[model samples]
Target chain A: MEEDENIKKLNPVEMKLLTHIIKNEWKTLIRGKWVIGYGLIFLILTDTLLRFGGGGAEVLLSLSNVMLLFIPLVGMIYGILYIYQSREFVELLLTQPINRKTLFWGLFCGISTPLMAAFVVGAMLPLGWHGILAQDPGASVMVLALGGMLTLIFVALGFVLGLAFYEDRIKGFGFTIVIWLFMAILYDGLILMAIFTFGDYPLERFVIAATMLNPIDLARIMVLLEFDISALMGYTGAVFRQFFGTNSGILTASGMLVLWLAVPAWIGLRVFKKKDF
Target chain B: MNNYKPIQLHLFGGLILLLLAWTSVSEASASDTAADIVVSPDGPVVSIQEAVNMARPGDHIRVEAGVYVESNIMIDKKLTLEGIGYPEIDGNLEGHILIIAADSVTVSGFFLKNSGRSHVRDYAGIYIDKAKDVVIENNRLDNIFFGIYLSATERGVIRGNEIRSYERRESSSGNGIHLWNVKDPKILDNKVEGQRDGIYLEFAKGAEISGNRSNNNNRYGLHFMFSDDSVYRGNTFNKNGAGVAVMYSKNVDMIDNIFENNWGTSSYGLLLKDINDSRITGNRFYRNTVGIDSEGSNRVIVHRNDFELNGWAVNIKSSSRENQFTENNFIENSFDVRTDSPRNPNHFEGNYWSHYEGYDLNRDGIGDVPYRPVRLFSIIIQRQPESLILLRSMFITLLDTAERIMPVLTPATLIDEKPKMERIR
Candidate 1:
């Protein structure tokens, strides 16, 4: 009964420090020059492409190219680097009377929130300025939402990898690069080979399932569904339209994305709780 | 203006004299007194069928403006069936409104509607069978199975008619102006919409189809099968299921027509299948899925035409050969040329492609370097259609650039050696 009282008394102080940690992280990221530089890069890229891309849909497609290729890479690398750099700070915090769960949650929120803010501010400024968001609200919202989700998912993945191998920084960095490469490039190649090998089978269900397995493919199919150019897509596109054309399909895809974000973060939190400083 | 009035008066008097002499000659040729039989609601002959039955050869049946519920009004003699102020002929959704079984017949200025829809028989607003020198003109046909049908007829003229139907499916609809085994039919100044095919010709020879507007049909705007030695000029075909299909025909002259906005998976602005010796000149094909799709066609001269903003400017299949694509302007198409086979035998020369990047060093009108039109990406798309989603992606751009530099996988023979340096104006 005395131990329970002591633990209850320590919870309020840790909760107070959690907010402080979050605020400090936000200020640090905002004050950094790289945040503004990232925003400027996105603004220029979107504006220049919009000026020359001939159409709104074309511009969005080009932006999607950048988003799919670079967002995960940037998110994953940033997550690992930030966690690794803040190892001393985390160690210093552990020496205090704060609970491990509170520190881990505080750190996770700190790192991911700034990265997400950077991405959102960077992407939304140009899309809003060019009236792309207004012209096609559904597609623009989808693109932004998918980009944000990818940032969160990949960041969580980076965190999990970082916490799992906290002692070896190089190993953590190497794994992050390999994961990004596998998800972005090699996954699509494997899908193509599988489709060609199973060409004769009725592979619509299998194809849809496989797309859900890769977050990038899911995002691409979602955007393609919005474009409504099914004529170009001969048959598989017809299947995608048939499935994703409904409200249920959209709901399910979003639910899957949320679950994707939650699973890795949950696993990372568990690992952080048990890991030695 | 005041001095020309006397000359104008003199010209009017001469024209009146000519008209009187022409009427006398026509009267003498008939060799019988042509009586004007008026059919009104209160007249002795209250129905058009009775008037047509009472009329003899070389007679005139003037139908007064009233709702005449008639079906199967067969004319078996040479008669002039004229409608005064566009009389309404309601078939009561039963059968054909009028059937012309005789030669030298004229049925004009009537509003025909609601011919019966039948699968066993082909119902029409005006059906002419085995008739020569028939004139079915200035008629308004609505909600019909077939608007105007001419079968085994010679020297028929279907002019100045408006044909429309509210058919949603191709199986339930019929052609607007359907001709079978006809010779020398002059189809002019007609507007057709919402039918299966706006104008269909089968086994028709020496037809002159001009000044017609056909749009929004369930199938081809203008379809031809075995209709040889025909001419279609100054017509507009727009937004049909497939714009126009000319198959199994030879020596067809298609000039100065406009085909626009025929967009679908397998649609084309113009489809030439098994056609030979055709001349498609001075036409505009704009915004179609495929501007022109040719299969099993040979010796086709596609000259001085404009193909703009289509998915594929020209999709020529392997079976097409000896076709000359010369002096045409291909502007802003997704792919300027797409072919199934790797080898192209058709000649593509002196054409201006908007995407061509070659330079002219000698200040001549032609580019020094040849332009290869068939891209390796298009071949990949043909093999794997789902790769179309990767269109304009960086990976696709990289692959296309690599293929362009290496000249591998794309058709080597499908090059324009004499690409025009400037846009063909």
Candidate 2:
């Protein structure tokens, strides 16, 4: 009777917030046929590529390339557009008996969960059918986890940008695209130039630090290390092996990825708290 | 006619008398004092030195099964030193166990061990100096500075000997079979391991090394310097610091040898430096860092060899030219060919590459399109080694595909015009 009383004494506002987020996220995902269509396309492309290319590790590598290029773009664009399209809906929800934190989190989860679900279902179905998980569980799991982390990070970043420029949809979408472009393409080019420009000094530690700054390079290095091509890695690879070879390195990288997730979401929530509807 | 007959008869009589005198003199010398001296613990002669001192030229001294702590036992006459039951000759870490300085010497069936260690001199288990027609066979040498040292010796046969040492560093250990300024030495069926080099030949000519298994040495399995007209066949060299190195030699034939498991940062199956007019054929190089690292070598024919799972099947330096690589099977290597320079002067034809993607349009057992083994990424790696971490990346793959479609960065001349459609068995 005491346990039952303690359960009944829970905050009703939290319960209502959970239910509202689940209901809204589900409705949005069902209404958007393009999301389901893109998911099916991803599944077919991964399956076909795996079937034709060499199996297991090669498939994981190919999928990583696609994820690094397409996932952030899809997540960011969908995030900003969802926020703009649901502006009236969010305004209507704000008139209800809920706090700003609950409303912000509900909307953020409502937008991000469906995109994450689409990616997971699209990628995991093909990967499971091809027995990639059985062949190389470590690399497969790492690739999937990295993909998930990238989706969350970019979606949260999209929210931060969307909430900051709430009045101008063009500016919000434009900033999201630019950030994705910078992260995916231009960042690696700049890193390569830096490494080449300062080729004389020992740049092992510097390269590792630079890779951590970009999540895509971090995921790429993690996958490459799993391939055990250290013989071709030369000196910098040796340094990476010495450092990232331990469990501590993996822990640090994972923690940093989590931090990448948390910081943007916190900033987006702060922006939501002060926004004038 | 009569005068010629008398002169011929006199010449014949003189020849017969000379032959009779020679026979009598040889018989007298053979019967005079060249006795079989037996040295045993219970025999009249208990020491080998005493037996050797008491013997004359063409005599046989047999040492029985006992530990003879003797060093610098010089054989200055045409003598036969035979061990009756594999006697142990210990040098006690002093000097060479046995030294043969005369011609027609035979030292066989002994267990020789523990020669002195000196940086100044190469003490050996069996040292042959300025000798000809010397046969040093059926002996086991252990824990010696040099196992069998042949200096200024010719026509020496070193066969069926096992030489080993326990030295870890190359600076302190000597070679198992060291030949210096020797000619026509036949090294056959010797098993050498755990030495500086399994076999070292310098300034030697017309040597034939066959059927030897050299493994786990500190330095090279077999090293040759300025040794010309030498042929080494049917040898197995495995897991050495660096496999067989042939430097500054010409007209050498390396055939049917198995060079395997020599994997390190700077190791190779066979390293050729400044070698010309050599034929390396029918050999198998498996799992080496580099199968054949050729530098400044010319006119070499590398044919019908199998290179499997090596880091680089053939790493040819730019200084090497005019070499022919034909009918070789390159299977499952990380990189088929890595050259330092973009300009290729050598010929690579009719080799079966496992990564070849071209089809045989005319059914002639050769691909219609030529195959380029060197990738543009490999060129990038040559410039910036750290860029290898980006291997198999999308951007690099795109760059490679673009370069392949339009031959831009990779050298156009480094193509195998006749790649084999089927693997060469």
Candidate 3:
């Protein structure tokens, strides 16, 4: 509601300028052929997985594994590289008398939306074609929702990195890869280290908090909780007397994920507004 | 002198009538020695105990429809106690409803309830001891400590009985059909629920238990120890605290049974411990914590069974050796087979595993490459169960993929050499 009022406060000329920039971003994204290619990759992967990937639920599990590994990597790399490649375009836009908020929202939506839409639609079309939508709609939709949230989150983080290292492109690329590697791999290693370090004390709460901190881990947990409930259920009380993937757990994870999607982008926007470039 | 003569003549008349009644009973059947004695609420014989007292060996005592508040009604004669209209025999929280101490006794079509619980006594709706050729069937026992207790009996038939109780704790509850030191017992077509163990057997040999639905019990649906040469076929055990457990038994045949939805930390569809030379075939184990937990079990032939959606389909411990698993289908379990030790002596062949990614190139039904059932994650789980929280995580999958290419932590020899290309129906 507050956002709408702020948009309403803008005059007709500013509104036209905002819409014009957003339109230009969308046009270039479509003509770039990245979204179509991204969609095709998911399409073939999902189709092949559905056909030969151990019948029904096995296929879904394999697809989720692939999506968890690839979605964030693609989203972040594409987000940062898009900004680096389009630096001249951004500069040219700044020369025009446009509002920075309008430019920020335009760039944020322009890069994230196409990738998110391509992923969700590509993953969904094959499932519907195979009647998995009617068969097990809850799990299927949950997988897609997790993928969508992951794309938004990683892309937002990408924008933050892109803006932070605007002066040095090589440093920006190096940091983005390191960040992805840390979030995806090293974070888990750190968690294991902590668990082993505090093996005697009840470190279940610490482990869960650490997992929730990583957006990729949160997404993977959400998808696995839906598919492999029984095995995970066995783990819950068989060792630690803690619960995993309850309805409340899913809700809290999603709330954290929404924060993940917004904070990094908000930080990037703040930096953009204050920069003297 | 005249009064003595008259008394003697009356005694002589009574003796002649007794002889005629004896002759009539002998003319009925070759071995029959009595007549049908009807006991009703309004009849001369008002109670079942009174009817049993008056009946001779091989007599038929028909108890009509009435609530007979009785306890410890002992049948010492070889008689048939038949309930005509489903008569109720309420134990009134006292003790055993009926005790059969004689062989060739048949108790059927009775509604027995409320045999009081006691720590010292093995109270039951019907307690049979040291009897042979006994049949207890077509009865409904409710709120019993032990539904039907048989001990030191031979060739006993306990069939077509529905036993139910309300006790939730195993310490307070007792088994539905309790058999001990019995031989050649036929337990068939019974439904037992909410008991400690649905059907329990110990020191029982040549027992044939089939067509039973033992569900939702406090402990195992069917539990047997030291029971040799027992056959469990066509039984459905569901939602029990632990599913059917067979321990300290040999030459056991378990066929065509369904064990489902038994979910607990230590629950299993079939827990075979210290069992040897057993045949487990044609069974469907679904959605349990573990399908078959083979611990200290050996020489068991596990064939043609369907294990689906379990935490671990088959958890073969290191102590269990020389067991053969063939022509079975392991589908959609989180881990197909898990073990702690890497030294495996058991054989897995011709089973269709859903996790198997091997292809068949020779146009044969079996795959060319061997499929390893044990994964690296399961090994980690066995050692550090806390790592189970990382189930389905990317690290575990990557670790498993790397280990599959090079056998390191998992059981190196535990591979299904002849994996089926397609599911075995």
* lDDT of the candidates, in the order given: 0.83, 0.82, 0.86
Clashing pairs in 2: none
**Regions of candidate 3 where Cα sits further than 4 Å from its true position:** A1-47, A77-145, A155-176, A196-202, A223-239, A245-277, B1-70, B73-90, B102-111
lDDT, candidate 1, B111-161, per-residue tens: 999998999899999999999999988999999999999999999899999
Kindly provide the TM-score of model 3 when superposed on the true structure, using C-alpha atoms: 0.79
CA lDDT of B248 in candidate 3?
98
lDDT of 1: 0.83
Pick by TM-score: 1 or 3, better one = 3
- TM-score, structure 1 vs. true: 0.68
In CAPRI terms, model 3 is classed as acceptable
Task: Compare the candidates by lDDT and give the number of the best one.
Answer: 3
Question: What are the per-residue Cα lDDT tens digits for candidate 2 across B1-425?
Answer: 67699889999999999999999976774573443677787877887778877888888887789888899988888889888788998899998889999999998889999999999999998999999999988999999999999999998899999999999998999999999999999999999999999999999999999999999999999999999999999999998987889999999999999998886667789999999999999999876768899999999999999987676789899899999999998875656788987699999999988667678879999999898888777787677766655554556666676777688777789989999976687
Residue runs of model 2 more than 4 Å from their true location after superposition: A1-194, A206-277, B1-37, B41-44, B58-60, B84-86, B391-395
DockQ for every model, please: 0.14, 0.08, 0.29
Query: How close to the true structure is residue B19 of candidate 2, measured as C-alpha lDDT?
Result: 100
lDDT, candidate 2, A99-170, per-residue tens:
667677777777777777777788888888888878778878888778878888888887888888889988
The candidate 3 chain A region of ten consecutive residues with least summed lDDT is A236-245
User: In DockQ terms, which candidate is top?
Assistant: 3
